[model samples]
Target: MIGSPITPQGVIERKRGIGKVEVEVKNMQSDKDREEDMDRLSDLPDFVLLHIMKFMSMKHAVQTCVLSKRWKELWKRLTNLALHSSDFADLAHFSKFLSWVLSNRDSSISLHSLDLRRKGCIDHELLDMIMGYAVSHDVQQLAIEVNLNVKFGFKLHPSIFSCKSLTFLKLSIWAVPWMTELPSSLPLPALKSLHLEHVTLTAGEGDCAEPFSTCHVLNTLVLDRCNLHHGAKFLCICNSNLSSLTIGSTTQETPYKFVLSTPNLRSLSVMRDPIHQLSACDLSFLEQVNIDVEAYFNAHFQRTHLALISLLQVLADYVKTMILSSSTLKILNGLSTSGSMITQIPCFVQLKSLKLKMKSSSSISDEGVSRIVEYLLKKCPLAKVDVINCRE
Candidate 1:
């Protein structure tokens, strides 16, 4: 056995044995090195990891459970949860997944934000349970966009209105031909931002209470195509702390009146619609005004023209920047010919920037627009004017 006239076959067998041993040793070393290496992701603190996972969808966050033992339980501590019903195969699967997540998630950590978007069939019970969970967990921001099923009479969990820690709440309900009734009282004292889309707000009449009056500290309010259901006759938005307000409704005319009492409003943007009888208290603090009211110019020109005048009168003195729709030029051209009211137009004392937004459908000629610009320039000679043309 000790090299007694070794043949080529014997030498080859010995070399194979040496190679096998070397491979085994290398495998052992590699395994040891892998075991010694620490997972960089697992090294992150729970809050940091959770924050990073916020950018990922809930499904991907849950999929991280397969990565390692540490990640198995890490997803349960996610503070920002975004759950979409469409992510699952069916409503039942979505419900089961949601239930499992809610039951297993660390309830001690206060939820930072919960965004739930559902496009398909309505699940009122699931929605209520989710709201209840969010409310109980001190959710700071809650955004819910669901397709409304009017037959079921959809209602938000009562605890949402009473959440002490809630700061931002956005509820956008679509697919409902009729406006959804609002809860009589929304006493969310801590709420700062409220965005409502396609929902009905009933003014305080009889048992119903004014929805926005209690939002004392609300700073940003966006009302997109919302209706002021007239159980009371007037819809008053009287939040003194409101700084940014956007009212986007396409309805040409409505029976109810809108009253705004925001003394500290700094930014105002109204697009598409003009409230029939909107009366605003002193807006002396308004810094920027964006008025894009060209939708109903031809049909209801007179009323819309008056509303524009009123709005400009209220905002002219303090507005540093003004964005006017092309229809405004047409209105001004018409007003100049009609009477001396054009000269009575309020001067823009604080105006620094003036933007004329022209749309493709604008009927006003370039000469007319120039004339209107001349009139406005007389009012705010120091303000720089910029013309922007938009296609639809």
Candidate 2:
């Protein structure tokens, strides 16, 4: 046997044996690399991978399946889901996709944020169902933008108002006939920031009292283009912890007096709304005030001018920064230079910076502008006055 000559059959079999051994070795190496990739892909932990997937669109997350078997089902456990109806061609497909995603996603994983921007007309029931599901699972940041031109929006469900986990809430509506039912008692214990735009508050004579009175931790509040209820006597905000407030309720039909009692408010802005009356209490900590009153007071500038000056007189001593419209200064200048009775400009003891926001087509003469500046320099000798034309 030792000296037997090798035949063709034996040679062929020997060559095939070598090839099989080589293939087995290569296969073992490939299996080891795949195992490592499945476990420690780029040294990233599973939670890190999931955090990355949360930022990606659902479709892109699903496509990560092609990467490897480990990533096949990772998208189903994403913690953040931001969906918009505008991305879909029609309602049917959009509904189908959202339904599938919500139903198939892992139920145990709590949602961190859910941003749903619906531009099309949608059923209120569907919205409630989505919101209900989110609130039940401890959603932290919720932003619902329902900018519909149709007349089909309903009052928000109570669960949304009393959610204990929401930290940031923004609700924006365009022309939708939205009847906002502000819960007389909102239990947003964890809410820190709230923003509402173009929303209509329901009619209630003190019926909507203490809407945000329970929000102990709220710091920033914004209301833009919000129409007050006919019976709403006063929009009172008495948050001791509040720091910034921006009110832009310019609607004239329903005039509700603004009664703010924020002791810690630092920056305050009131624009657009020719607010009928304002009563602010304990603003000893206020540092900035920006008031832009255009159409409402311009109708009867004489009366409104005197009223604005009175309000400024009370705030001129405390505020460090003031951003007022040019028209306001012109009116104030009128009051100061009139021959009948020269009104006194309040001394801005603490005012350090003055910014005048005007239109490009400002009709106020250079002399008029100089008079206001000279008046400010005379009163606040150390103040820096600047002009800014904010017209496009």
Candidate 3:
């Protein structure tokens, strides 16, 4: 009976004592005093504050003004403004938010990059307004990816082609009017890199002018999933300084054709198109050629394979390194009339290295692989041949 410290009443008394202590601590500070203390604690330096704001979207950063008077104006001075409306309920609301942000942006804006990937279709007027803002701020990089459905037929503003300070530009549109053509003359002298995805390159009405030929300093060009319809000729109008070119998913029946007149082109990668025949003008200066042709197994596949072999025969004489990955290697294995024809691989005499990616069940037996190796050894005695199973 030493004070019965373990009793239930003793436990209740200890709990009451803790509650009273917490109440006393809470009563020492009023709401106004706590808010003032928080305000003083949040007074970050300008550079530190800008860095923090950079992690937030323009809309959320702007909304912080409701937090306090000091934060209300801090977002206005941010040099970088990125507006993304991916979570908005509709395009109208997203557009209204963008309008509000643009209206309140500082006049002495240091904005250098603007990336807008809104989920809904944006009208041309709204796009033009954003482009105008980007130009006024001397934006150096602009990337816009829009999923414009076929029903809407959205078009980009022509004024966007004139941003003089833009060095890198990437544009992807799902559906657009065939009548909407690229600007005939790109005035962006500083544009060095360009990527076009799902863009239609139609020959404009009247004498079609090559829009990209004026990009004298352009060094990289990539075309993916582009539809060159209505007899549009894929021409290399500019890019004399181009060093890398990638052409992927061209229409097989559209007879897509283009010339690579760039004498400095170092690498060329082409992927999966039946139009495998390259004209004399294409890749004349290429030092390395990587061809990944999707073989259509049928009468069409046979014909296409022969055409591609002819193309390889042409490239074998000039290309220092050749890489081939596709079902075409299986077709080549079937080309040997007899085992003695192994010496025919010499057509690629200039090849210093040859990489052949074959499928495990690609109709290429161990014997067939050995035969092809012998043929290659005869043609390029000093060449190194590496075979890899692509399926793995």
- Winner by TM-score: 1
Candidate 2, 91-150: lDDT as tens digits = 777777778888888899888888888777666666677789889989999988865434
How accurate locally is residue 247 in candidate 2, as Cα lDDT from 0 to 100? 78
lDDT of each: 0.79, 0.75, 0.69
For model 2, the stretches where C-alpha displacement exceeds 4 angstroms are 1-43, 62-67, 148-153, 202-208, 296-314, 325-347, 357-365, 376-378, 388-391
How many residue pairs in model 3 have overlapping backbones?
Answer: 2
| TM-scores of the models, in the order given | 0.81, 0.77, 0.73
In model 3, residue pairs whose N, Cα or C atoms come closer than 3 Å (at least 3 residues apart or on different chains), thus clashing, are 342-375, 346-379
Residue 6 of model 3 has an lDDT of 86
RMSD of each: 5.0, 7.7, 5.5
Lowest summed lDDT over 10 consecutive residues: which window, candidate 1? Answer: 249-258
lDDT of 3 by residue, 127-173 (tens): 77987888888888888777654433345666678878888888876
Candidate 2: what lDDT?
0.75
Residue 342 displacement (Å), model 1: 5.4
Worst 10 residues of 2 by lDDT: 201-210
TM-score of 1: 0.81
